[model samples]
Target: MEILFYIVPALMIALASCAVAAVIRRSLRISRAWNSGLTAEARCLRTYTTTSGGGDSSVRTTVHHVYAFTTRDGRGVRFEEQGGPGTTLEGDIVTVHYPADRPEHATARPPARGKLVAGTGCLLAFLGTFILFAVGFMVVTYAMFSAVGDFSQP
Candidate 1:
């Protein structure tokens, strides 16, 4: 339908904006943690892969690692590291950064640039969709006016 032309692009733009905002928010949080200067040597306790989908659709596998570390105060913390600098084998040692107040919320040292890249890509998508819609609207308007011929006086 003609309405879909407007609805689809609006939805795409909204989705892209949401994605970009999420990436920026996450990046800021990680930046804060990185700047906190609290760090520890974490050990990968275990590694696992989760697979989803079958039959009709292709399966997607996500790798997750559980890491344990001790804070400066000797508090032991274990958490699942998601989507960054993943370690494939158990017992691998890596450095992690965290806020003193929130030791459980940590990030791997030398944070991955994937978030930044994703944010940029989403922002570009948002801009591209917006421009495409604007040009489309203008062309449609011009075509409509041209088809109507002169209307000033006759």
Candidate 2:
């Protein structure tokens, strides 16, 4: 039971670290693609919305768009990704950045630094809250056991 006190906080920290690393890695990849001139004018082929969750209050919505383009070497590529709904429409042209070798792993644009910072800050805050709760629980449990003294039979 006491092991849980250590495990919860460690798990939260690990999750936060992984999330931050993913964000940085993605940012670097996007930067490299743009700087290397691996870009193409992709056309929006179709747009769709997906919904998930069971309860009324827990419903979630995501807008996904499918795009197709031709690379400089004359390779046709098609991919789907989540994006703003109204910002793009069927037949709208958008610039896509991707690696020369893997056109499937592409992004519509570079990530916004401001949004990244805000997201990281939020993640850290969430981790901090869980750590505090775990520590508080451990302290309270220890205090209760100490006050009750040892239970032994003679």
Candidate 3:
């Protein structure tokens, strides 16, 4: 029963680390997709105002929208633009890149801050998991060894 205390925590930490790694991998994949130019006729839509919160005193926030046209095998392919904040407005054409093989795989040029935010999040998650695992390991080892000494005494 006592062994479970150590094993469970270690397993949890390992799982958390794997989850963070998966996020990092996905981000990299998206970066590559954007660079490959898979989408067509990509254009930045006009900014729209959206209401946030409830009540008359609710704050109005500006959201930038973008549109992209994708085609496959010389045929028109249906694609939708997504993402919010820091996106380019309508009539303002932004650079759109995606993989040639996968026209649907695309993304707008993300702002520097966006990249920074994602990178920071991933770093923190990784570091946090590592620290938790290390501390747990040390604590478990110390407790186990101390128990051994206690048992030998009487």
Candidate 4:
């Protein structure tokens, strides 16, 4: 019983860690999907006028024009692209990484390596939690039965 008190808490912690890790992995996958189908060809830096919502405010700001060169199974595909805030602009020529099996599906930026790492880590965490729970349950059950046996002994 005393041992079970300790094991139960450890099991709960491991399970909670596994849940958080899973959420992180899912977010990574979404980001990878959005980036995978983009390619870069050229960039144009110029000042453009920006407008706010219903407010009477308009501003001029410098923006970069990004052109992407996409290829689908050896066929060329072209698209005009732009960089969002906080994203690095690697000049006119940008490397696009795509799935070899599906060339049409590509990204301007390489897929994140952390996603794979996080996924593996989460899986391991879940496995560890289950193992701890199983072992603790077995130990507690055995101790309970042993106590019963001792009480009945003549």
Candidate 5:
């Protein structure tokens, strides 16, 4: 029981550190990919619905899309990604960034909505970590003080 006082805070700190690193890594990846090329219009070739996580745990529907685009040098390229509702649809024209030297590598050009969502998630994780650690520290400190008792009176 008392051991939990130390263990829980350690776990909370570790979780926060790992989540922060992950968010940073993801941001770097997107930034590098976008800077790799110029924007090009891509047409969604096909879309399909996929179910993820079910059975009273977690469940959500995601749209899988395949897009085709022609590069500046007249090379046809295809890219696929999964997105939420209405994010991807058949025949929908979307702007994507791709390396001129490598049409095979392409990504949606800085989707504002996705960035907002990711930022919000990272913020929440950090906030939760702080709250958890503060509460745990208070509980442990209170327990230790109470155990020591008032020594001023001798």
Candidate 6:
């Protein structure tokens, strides 16, 4: 219906904004990891895959990983990464990065340019959708108003 034209774009734009926020936050976090001066060796404690939300329309599987590391001051930290799995395997030694003052906030080093590209991609997609919605809204409103004027011309 005509009402859908207005409602759908509003919903899409709102959802897209959330996606943009998530991508930006993730990119900033990864950028911090890459820029940190402190480094340590971490081991992948475990890796597993989980399947969910898959039905007739879509099927998806996500990989989960856990890592453990020790800082220079002999402080130990363990975390579960929620960004799916990386190339590391259980017991594999991986490089970690963290602010020297916050060794407890360490994260595995992401590949060069990976986070930037992902954030850029999300932004571009959102921009495209926004442009499309704006154009559609203008066209629909213009047509509707024109039709009303035509009817009023008796």
Q: What is the TM-score of each predicted model, taking all chains together?
A: 0.62, 0.64, 0.51, 0.29, 0.54, 0.70
Q: Which stretches of candidate 4 lie over 4 Å from their true place?
A: 1-71, 74-98, 101-110, 149-154
Q: So what's the TM-score on candidate 3?
A: 0.51
For model 4, the local distance difference test gives 0.52
lDDT at residue 125 of model 3 (Cα atoms) = 74
lDDT of 4 by residue, 1-154 (tens): 4556556766776676676666566555445545466443423232233443555665545433344454544555443333333354444355655443444444454456686567667776776666677667767766887676644457
Q: What lDDT does each candidate get?
A: 0.75, 0.75, 0.61, 0.52, 0.72, 0.73
Candidate 2 lDDT over 1-154, as tens digits, reads 5556557766775676676677667656655666566888999999999888966678888899998999999999998888555579899999988888778777776546577557656766775676677567767867875797545533
Lowest lDDT sum, 10 consecutive residues, model 2, at: 145-154
Q: How many steric overlaps does candidate 4 have?
A: 6
| Model 3: per-residue Cα lDDT over 1-154, one tens digit each | 4556567767777776777777676576567765554545665545565656668576766554646554555744334453454535566665555667665656565535477557858786776868687667869776887777644355
Overall local distance difference test of candidate 3: 0.61
lDDT of 5 by residue, 13-108 (tens): 777767767766656555555777577899988999888788877997877778898887778899876663466678889888776666666776
Model 1 agreement with the true structure over 13-103: per-residue lDDT tens digits: 6775676577667676777678788889998888888889999999987878888999999999998866545445788888888889888
Per-residue lDDT, model 6, residue 52, is: 75
- For each of the candidates, the C-alpha root-mean-square deviation to the true structure, in angstroms, is 5.7, 4.1, 6.9, 12.5, 6.2, 4.1
What does candidate 5 score on TM?
Answer: 0.54
Order of the predicted models by TM-score, top scorer first: 6, 2, 1, 5, 3, 4
lDDT per residue for candidate 6 within 39-62, as digits (tens), equals: 888889998887777567576677
Candidate 6 residues lying further than 4 Å off, grouped into runs, are 1-4, 82-87, 101-105, 126-131, 138-146, 149-154
Please list all clashing residue pairs in model 1, or write none if there are none: none
Q: Give stretches of model 3 more than 4 Å off.
A: 37-39, 43-68, 72-83, 86-95, 111-135, 138-154
